[model samples]
Target: MSHEIELKLALPHRALPALRRHPLVSAAQKLGNAVTLDNTYFDTPALQLKARKVALRIRRQGRRQLQTVKCAAVSSGGLSQRPEWEQDYTGAFDFGAIDQPEAAQLLARHHDALVPVFTTRFRRETRVYSPREDLRILMMIDTGEVSLHTPDGVERSAPICELELELEAGQPLDLIELAETLASDLPLMPADLSKAERGYRLFLGTPSTAVRAEPSAIDATQNAVDAFRTLAFSCVRQWQANAAGALEHTDPDSIAADFIHQLRVSQRRLRALLKLFAPALPATFVADWSVRLRENANRFGDARDLDVFHAELFAPVAPEGLADEASFSALASTVRRAREEARAHACHNLDMATQGRLLLGLTADLHRLTIDSLIQAADLRTFARLRLDRLRKRTRRLAAAAETLEPTRLHALRIGFKQLRYAVEFFAPLFPARAVRRYLEAVVVVQDTLGFLQDVDAAQQRLAAWVAADARLAPAAAFVLGWHAARYARLRRRALRESTPLLSGRKPW
Candidate 1:
C-alpha cells in the first residue's frame, strides 16, 4: 500500500500545443514516448464499492495488466492524498495485497459480484520534473475519454484532457508552486475530479450541475487558527468548484446563472471569514485576500444583478392591467439584451489562466500559512463566542440606525445583517444546535428582507437609466416600481421590527 499525493489540472485541448512548447516542458526529461492506457473499473452490480468511496480498476499497458485499489480522501483545489494498492493481475481478482482491513474485507466479500462498470482509454505522455536534488515530480498528460457501454451496445463518453502532477519526492506545496508557474502562461485550471470519479459519473449518467456551499467542518476541539483554516478551505472548495463549472461552457447561453451567483457567494463567504478571524490571522493575509476576492467577485456582479432584476423584479410586474403593453414589451426586450451582453462579458472574462493562478496561489499560501503561537493555544469555542458577540452588537447598532429608513443606513444595516448571519452560520457547530438554528432562522429573515429592499433600490437606478434613454420606458419603469412599492415599504418597516428580537434576544454562542 502506498499513499498517492498528486495534483490534477484540466487543460483545454486547444492549449496542448502551448503546453508542449513551454520551456519547462521542453527542459524536463521525457520518460518515454506517449503510450495508450486502457483501463476498466469494476464494481458490484449494486455498486457496493462505490458506496464506500472505493475504486477498483485494472489497467492494460501493452501486454501487462495491473490491478489497483484506491480509496477516496480529502481532495481540495485539485490536490489529493489517498492510499492505494497495486499489484500484477494475472487473471482473477485479488484482494490479498490490500492491507486496509475494511477494504480487504469488502472486496473479498463482493469479489464474485464485481463486474466491469466503465472504461477509460487515454494516451499518456509522462515526463520527470526534477528541479532540485530532493524534489522529483511526474508530469503526465492524459487526453482521452471516459466511456460507458450499455447492454444494448450503445456507448456514451465524456472527453478527458488533463495533466497530473504526482510528487515523487518533495512537499505538496512545491507541486502547487509548479502548477502556478505553468498556469502563468498555459490555460490550466485545477481540477478536483479524478479519472475514477469521472468514470463513475459517466457510468451513472449524472449531469454536471452548479456546486453550492457546504457546511464547514470546524469543530470545538480545534484551536482558533485550525478552525479558521478548515472553514477557509471549505470556502476555497466552493469557489474552485463554481469557477470550474463556469469555465466548462464557452457559450454564454449555456452558462448557468447559479454558477456565477454561487461563485460570488463563495468569495463573499471567504472575505467574511477572513474578517471574522482577522485578529488571529496575519494582517497582510487578511488585507490582501479581502481586496482580491472583492475585485474578482465584482467582475460577475452585473450579470447576477441583471438576473435578479429580470427574474424577481420585472417578471413579477403585471403590465397587463396598469401599463402600455408595447412599452412594457420594449423594456423587457432591452433588459434581455442587456442581460445577454453581461453574461457574455462574464463568460469571456472567466479566463482559465487567470483563475488557475489565483486558485493555485491561494491554495499554496493556505498550505504554508502559520498561526501565531498564542492564538494557536486559544480555545476555538471561546474565540467563536467573542466573534459572534462582536458581530451581533455591530448588527444591533446598524438595525437601530436603520429605523429612520434612510436608504444609505438601510444598506449599511443590510451589510451588517449579512455579516452577522454569515458569522452565525460559521460558528453554529460550536454551539447548541437548537439555539443556533433558531437564531439563524431569524437572522436569515432579517437579512433577506433587507436584501429585497436593497435589490429594489438598485433596480430603481438601472430602470431610471433605461427610461432616460427612451421616454417610452418611463411609464413601464413607473409601473414596475409602483408594483413593488407596497411590499418594499412594508418590508422596510418589517426589517427593523423583526431584527429587534433577534438582536436583543439571548445569544446562541
Candidate 2:
C-alpha cells in the first residue's frame, strides 16, 4: 500500500482565469497534460463500504481505466494522508493489490455486492512544480459536475470546481510552502470534503446540517503544538463543512440558516481556543488569525442575530399582543427580507477573492507549524492544566465581583467563562468522563445563564437600532423592548446567582 498526502482546495469558477495566470502555475517546472476524467464511485446497496470508511472508484481516461481504493484517512485543514491502493483495470473489480488487511478482506467478502452509486465527469488541467530537487507538487485544476443517475434514466448533479495540490515527493513543509506561494495570488480555500464524500452525500440525498465538535484525539504524550493543531483543525473542519453548505444553498429558509449559525459557533470556538492556547503559540501567528476569525464572525453576525430573533424571540411571543397577526406577519416578512439580504451580503463577502486567499494562507500556516523547544519537551497534561487553572482563577475573580461589575466588565467576565468552558470540552477526553461531566454541568449552568443575559442585551440593542432606522417600526420595537426590560434584569440577577457553583467547583483534571 502507498500513502497519499495532498492538500485540496475548492474555488469558484471566477477564480480560474486568475489562477491560470498566476506565476506558480504559469511558470511551473512543467505544464503537464490535460485530460477528461470520468470517475464512478461504487458501493453496496446498503452502503457497507461507506460504513467502514472505504472508498472504491474506477476512472476512465481516454481508453485507459484505473481502479483505486482509499481507506479511512486522517484529514484536517484540507490536508489528508491515507493508505491508498491503485492498479490498472482489466474490465473488472480488483482487490488483489490492496495490502491493508481490513480493506482487502472486506472487499473480498462483498465484491459481488458492489455497484456504481455516483459518477463525476470533469476536465482537468495539470501542472507540476519543483521548488527544489527533492520536492515536487502536482497541481491540477478540475472543472465539471458530480452526478447521480437514477434507474429511471434521470440524473441529478452539482457543479464541481476545485484546485488540488498533491505531494508527488518531498517533506510536508515543501507542500505547505508551495501552497502558500500559490495562495498569494489565487483565490483558494482549503477544502475538507473529498469528491467521493460529496458524491456519497448526493447519492444518499442527505441534507447538510450543523456539525458538532468531534472529540480531540490529543494524548498525554503529544506536544502542546500538536494538541493545538488537532483541536484547531477540528474547529476548522466544523467551520468549513458548514460554510460549504451555507454557500451552496440558494434558498434563505433552507439548510443555510442552520449552517450559518453553526459556522458562527465554530468561529467562536476557534477564537476561544486560540486565546486559551495563545501563550504557547507564536504570537504573530495567533494575532493574525485572531483578527481573521473575528472578521468572519462579524460577517455572519447580522444574519445569525436575525435568525435568533425569528426563531427564539418573535415567534414565541407573537401571541402576547406585541403586534396583531397581520402586523406581525408584515414584520416577520420585513425581517425575513433583511435576513436574506444579510445572508447574501455575507456570502458575497465570503466568496470574495481575498477571503479564499486568507483561508488558504491559514491552512498553510497551520501545516507549517512546529512545536517550539519550550513547548515541544513539555508534558501535554501539565500544559493543559496550567492554562485551565489560570482561566479558572480569572473566572473565580470575575464571578466574585459579578454583581458590582460594569456591563462591559461583566461581558468580559462572561467571555472568560466561555473560554474556560471551551477549554474543558477540548480536553475532556483526556480526563475521567464522570468527573468531567460533574464539572461541566456546573459550568454549563453558569455559561448558559450568561448567554441568556447577553442575548437579552443584544436583542434590546438590535430592536433599538431597527426602530431608529425606521420610525414605522417604532411601536412594535418599543413593545418588544419594554417586554424584555424587566425580564432582562431578573435574568441578569439569576445569572449572577448561578455563577456561585462554577466559581466554587473543583477542577476535574
Estimate every model's Cα lDDT from 0 to 1. 0.90, 0.79
Per-model TM-score on C-alpha atoms: 0.98, 0.92
Q: Per-residue CA lDDT of candidate 2, range 1-509, in tens?
A: 89899888888898899988898788885554788999999999999999999999999999999999998877766778899898999988989888888899999999999999999999999888886788888888899999998888877898899988889889776766676677777767777788998898888788677787777677887888888888888887887777767777755555367777888888899888888788888899899899999988888788888777767666666445546555455556677787788877767665534545655567678877877788888888888888888888888888777777456656767887888889999888778889988888887887776776676667777777776776666667666666667867776778777777666756698
Candidate 1 similarity to native, TM-score: 0.98
The superposed Cα distance between candidate 2 and the true structure at residue 176, in angstroms, equals: 2.9
Q: Write the per-residue lDDT of candidate 1 for residues 132-247, one digit (tens) a residue.
A: 99999999999999999989887899999999999999999999999989999998888998888898888888867778878868888888778888888888889888998888
Cα lDDT for residue 23, candidate 1:
94
- Any idea what lDDT model 1 has? 0.90
Candidate 2 residue spans exceeding 4 A from truth:
29-32, 250-255, 319-334, 405-409, 469-472, 485-489
All candidates: CA RMSD in angstroms? 1.2, 2.5
